[model samples]
Target chain A: MWQPSIAPDAVDRIACVGAGVIGGGWVAHFLARGHRVTAWDPAPDAEDRLRRLVDAAWPALEALGLADGAARDRLTVVGTLEEAVADAEFVQESAPEDLALKSDLLARVDAAAPAGVVIGSSTSGYRMTDMQRAAAHPERLVVGHPFNPPYLVPLVEVAGGESTHPAAVAWAEEFYTLAGKTVIVLDREVPGFIANRLQEALWREALHMLAAGEATVAQIETAVTAGPGLRWPFHGPCSTFHLAGGEGGMAHALDHFGLENPWSRLAGPALTGDLRDTLVTGAAQVTAGRSTTDLIAERDRRLIAVLRALREAQA
Target chain B: MWQPSIAPDAVDRIACVGAGVIGGGWVAHFLARGHRVTAWDPAPDAEDRLRRLVDAAWPALEALGLADGAARDRLTVVGTLEEAVADAEFVQESAPEDLALKSDLLARVDAAAPAGVVIGSSTSGYRMTDMQRAAAHPERLVVGHPFNPPYLVPLVEVAGGESTHPAAVAWAEEFYTLAGKTVIVLDREVPGFIANRLQEALWREALHMLAAGEATVAQIETAVTAGPGLRWPFHGPCSTFHLAGGEGGMAHALDHFGLENPWSRLAGPALTGDLRDTLVTGAAQVTAGRSTTDLIAERDRRLIAVLRALREAQA
Candidate 1:
């Protein structure tokens, strides 16, 4: 078992290979943490796009008490992947979700970066093995899958493949911790890692509920957000059961509800053919007239405000 | 198709059938809403227990801006269910989770309460059909499931069986809305109804992960409370997916991950006998050395404070 350890020094240097939404988030997160970030993307006008994203993210980061002059001074825009990764202690790869493109980029990064640099992939789907195979030093590659807008959210799942160096894993965990992220180390390689896997399960069941006519999309969303969603932030399922058991704990609650599991239609077998169409239609109907961009921006703003309040309270 | 209407005025008079933890919560909620509450429970010292629960709940109610001297003056202790329900506008049944006992109590309540009184069950499990079958006027019985400590939590799931009266449903909805709850009307009857159904699905998956050794108990809790749990309070799974799709919608994200669903093992198959034991053990180990009573009290205190702050800010 590999234990996680954090370095005592401040993380002042960072690099990112892509500057899309996820990559832009990585840049914002590092810059918010007072790390100088160098980023490169193949898209035309990538620097302009990245600067716009940074500007959009600034208020939220500042609201969270993270973005400041010292942190802002560390940001650097680079023209190429080599320029981005060179001399960086930590690198985050957020290239497009293509195995071939990601593998090729890892090979290039391996050649350009120093041996001690930790390369973390932001790929939500691909395993570490897929990207590490192209790297000259496979041990240095790890997956540091972060939720969207890495600066506002606190979870970063750190995973490693068979060839991923234990030291690299430790370094990646430490770096994220110093970046003010709560890191979870994956015991082994798994697709979607941890968060997405749990989310997919929830989405699958939610779609099934919509399809079966049990509840409308609006009611379902309202039920979750107003109910379980309220408590989930403070307690996960298991702790919920512990509390539900009254004085007995999870064992009692499980014994009481355990038998009901098989009887309840949890998830539809699987989505096939037209069932997929039904899901899309249901989702569209539910979210009709709602602006995704507006919602994201609103959610990000609220998150930063809440986190900022909590941080201030702690201080 | 039923459209969700505005909640009715707070019940002027409430009759509580049992005074356990859940029953006591009902007393606190109704009383805090300025209803004259008549509470009855066979358990020895039930009144004392109910009083302690209410005293503890006062801070939470005050935080929600619902606790006032006038609101607190409306509570009345009674010797029997008959006395409690007599001439009441709304009767909230929160008896122990025994089907036969609930049926017997509802039967007696039907005999005693006025014909126009709406009877709501604060049950987390029993189906409305079963509870109503024992009532002389089954049409008056409806499910009004509230989360723990009804005085603080704002969610109230209003569901009715086939035999339940439409008028009763409307009345229950109105009453809950007046008391400041986000009411979700379930069109069809289902075990655990909507909120618990979603919760159970998530819990089942979390247990499977713990049982499979994919993640430790602490990691799983951290993964949620610090990760998606952070955002879920404001944006649910569908909303999150909508954001994940960037400019697109859930459809875009679904198309991207549709294939991965089949390939990924999000959660192990429903937990079996021994796996159930492992899950319980893991939860206990995770919460080891912590007193649940203290935790519950602390959680209640914090929830009250947070909700109060939000309410004050809104004001």
Candidate 2:
């Protein structure tokens, strides 16, 4: 097992590649934690858009509280990928989900960063085993997946590729934790990891209902926000069922509810033309004439409020 | 079409046919809403268990806010199901999942209740089409499914079967809304209804992961409460993806991320002996030897805190 060249809490320089939504989120998060962040993206307007995204997210971070020296100006936009990682103690790549592009980009980052520095990919779908194939120092490659609006949401899933050292995975987990994140480290690689698999299952089920015309889009949204979604923020599906079993807990739940039920018979529906139109129309009805920009502002507002509420509740 | 004999807002006397967890929760909910509740269950000690359940739930209800004149003494446990429904303005059946048992019980309640007083079944699994088979007055028998801890969680999924009247379905929706619930009325009968289908999909996916040894129970639980679960309380799967697509919304999300992919391949796993053992053991690890009763108390406490937080956030 390889050892981390730099300790997790002592590191102050974070390099971020690809400043789109996810990459820019990482930049904002690292800066808020009082780190010097170097960000690089190929788009001509990447610096402008990245700054705007960070500026939009600042109020929420401020409400959440910043580190001793944290400030947005600590971020430096670099001209090239090599310059970005030239002095970075750690590197995070948030490139597009294309496998070839990610693999090639990770290889370049791996070559430029100091030897033994861990490199994490933010590819939501591809496995690190696949992405690390072209990297020279593959042992240091790991996946550290974060939810959208990473500057706010506390979860980050960390796992290593086949060639990754156990120490590297542990180091990444420690780094995330010290930087104020709740990390889940997987024992072995699983496609889509854990949360995404569970999420996609629900998403696919919703689509099936929409395609079959069994429920309206608004009903689907209400079925969640007004229903199980409330419990989810505190209790997960497993623990929720455990309580449903009464005093007997999960064993009683499994035995009492049985396994082969009608609900389990759901399969992913093929998204056809008619289904696509239904989803588009249904979503429009739910959107209720609000533009995406307007909705984002609303979502961020509510998210910050909810996060503060959760924090107070936990306290 | 059958019209509601009594107006939704005028419902004050409610008959509950079963007094287990779900049934007892209904008792607590209605009692807090200032309704006189009459309940019957066949269990020898059901009264003791039912009252205790309501008492345990009372503090949470009190935190949520009680309707004027609401009191625990307003609940009356009767000797027979027929007596329970005799003078009721509305009847809610929270019977066991056995087809024959529920069918015969609904038939009995039907023979005894005042005419046109709508009856709703809290069956988590059975379709109303099947459950209403033996009821004499099936048109008034609609499904009104609730999440566990029905009082605190504001969602109630309302739907009707093949023989039920559309007017009765509307009446139930209006009543639930007036009595403090967010209702989702399905246009047609769908097995397991809406929320349960979505919940079961996620449950099965978590089980699949557990069975495959890809993640631990703690990891699964943390994966949710820390990750997507935080977002779910306000936003849902569809709207979330809409935001994930950036300024383009749902249509762009669908186009950018193709329909069929690795995540869509999820299917229900068989509950083999080894898998069951793993689940039980993993759950034990999560419980950490805490008694089920202890866990329930903790769950209730946290749930109340979260409900209060959400309320304050919304305000």
Candidate 3:
């Protein structure tokens, strides 16, 4: 068991297991928020890669007005999981998404750590119940799935298993909130949680449209980015309906266009084999003559700038 | 029958029927793009309302760097549907979303317009097949559904029916493009088209979650706007998948997390009754003590600024 030396108001310490992309992102986020982070990964060059990833992300993070020296000074590398989670208040596990491997690793962490330490699994798959079943103390396990490049984005889904204690949930929420994240509590375990489910529905339709030769990938992408996608972030579906009703709210909108749902084509199956191939091919075609890496980098840079401007305006 | 003043660079004109919110929006858009507009509506204050709407939207259009006095000077409100479509190149029908009313009005416009004039219906309901079947010149009929506040948002889905001529489709695309609007053509007539379908899928799940006591409406709305909704506008579902895959792209992301789809709480019926009531009440609760009219105006103003900034950045 571990002992707490730091005051409650002092910066909390975070331990990250598996310094891959997600784990590296956790390091960046916690470090940026002035939390001391001890990271453990078996990969030979894990430390170097994590450092490089953080370095590469600095420009974008700084563009978002989040760069700070305290974040850089708080990062450390460790070889063993026990050492990483030794006295840490929060532990983030981002190992491979395999169930057995994660369960085994988490069980070890739970055994070594104190009862108060919150163990958050960054698994996008497997509900919290199944993953925490092997933990020595299942009450401390929680699902804290963060979006990619967690330091740049601010969404973290805080889900609890049946065995997870309410204190653990509150602690997880509080922890992420301090790290500049928007925490959403999932009432129960559900697959893909919230974001991914909505994403898949849209992706599936886009793929079907491509498969049916309805429109090219470029056209479909342009349609979304220039159309609905532009307004979606500011106004969700319900608000859109309210606006559509023209002062009558959603009920009026529904009364006017509710019957149209029956005529919509929502019967497409999952994107398997050839359909998936077509979608990939279409995306490539749409992005022809442009390097995806370069495109992504440019996009990231612009996004950071836009977010920064919005934040400054809000401030 | 109308006669075309045959010229190589003849100016295109649009006839707008029903000077309500949508019709007024269309007038603002067309007028802002230098398209002469002939508008007609039986509402007593239709002209005054349309003029006010145009005046209100002018700053936003100018902020987009696409508005000019030359375009604004071209608007002209006519006396009747006969005069509105008499000599115009295109007729935009924004009549109420009633089938019988729309069919009757469309038939009248068809009778008054030239033989080759394209009659585009801005109906969110009533597929092209249903609308065209009622027209005398079915070949000239097509659906040009635009989202709310069409003058500010630039997405128009141009769907053709079985009887719609290929020339009409091409002409409509060119027309919208010239007017600085992004046009997407649908493969077949799908109700709500592409955007609304994806939107409804997400909305259904959100409503279900609220109904099941998973979260309050305010929480759900907060989760969306502050979380995934933040990234959606800049990066769509597919692009987000690419990032989620840790630079490997959507395929890898799908392989890793695709299994979660089967377990998600999606695939539920649309929300109704109590749930719908809860959403409205929740929205009111969250928006209590706030003026919606002021909020809308502020949102519109921000949208205009963002679009202008983006345009300038692109240039």
- Indicate which candidate wins on lDDT: 2
Task: Please give the ranking of all candidate structures by lDDT, highest first, separated by commas.
Answer: 2, 1, 3
Model 3 clash pairs are: A31-A71
lDDT of 3 by residue, A47-149 (tens): 9989977766554455445534556757889889999998888889999888889989999999987667888998864688888888878888889988665
Q: Clashing residue pairs, candidate 2?
A: none
Model 2 misses residue A146 by how many Å?
0.5
Q: DockQ numbers for every candidate? A: 0.18, 0.25, 0.15
Per-residue CA lDDT of model 1 for B1-315, tens digit only, reads 232222356347778889876788888877776678889999888888788778766655554456344466578888877888886878889987667888888889988988767788887757889777877778878899987656655678898877887877888887888777889888888777777776666655655565455655566667776677655554566556555655444445554544343323433343334433332333234334244333322322332233333334334
| Alpha-carbon runs more than 4 Å astray in model 2 | A266-315, B267-315
Selected candidate, larger DockQ, 1 vs 3: 1
Q: What lDDT tens digits, residue by residue, belong to model 2 across residues A1-315? A: 566789998899999999998899899899989999999999999999999888877766675679999999899998999999999989999998888999999999999999868898887857899999998889999999998767766788898999898889999999999988899988888878888888888877777676566765667677887778877775677666656666655555655775556774554243344433433343344345445334333332333344445445447
| Highest DockQ against the true fold, candidate | 2
lDDT of 1: 0.67
Q: Residue A179: error of model 3 in Å? A: 1.4
Interface RMSD of each: 12.8, 12.9, 13.2
Worst 10 residues of 2 chain B by lDDT: B295-304
User: After best superposition, candidate 2 residue B75: deviation in angstroms?
Assistant: 0.6
- Ranking under DockQ, best-scoring first? 2, 1, 3
After aligning candidate 1 to the native by TM-score, how far in Å is the CA of A19 from where it should be? 2.0
Top TM-score hit: 2
lDDT string for model 2 (B109-132, tens) is: 888999889998888867788878
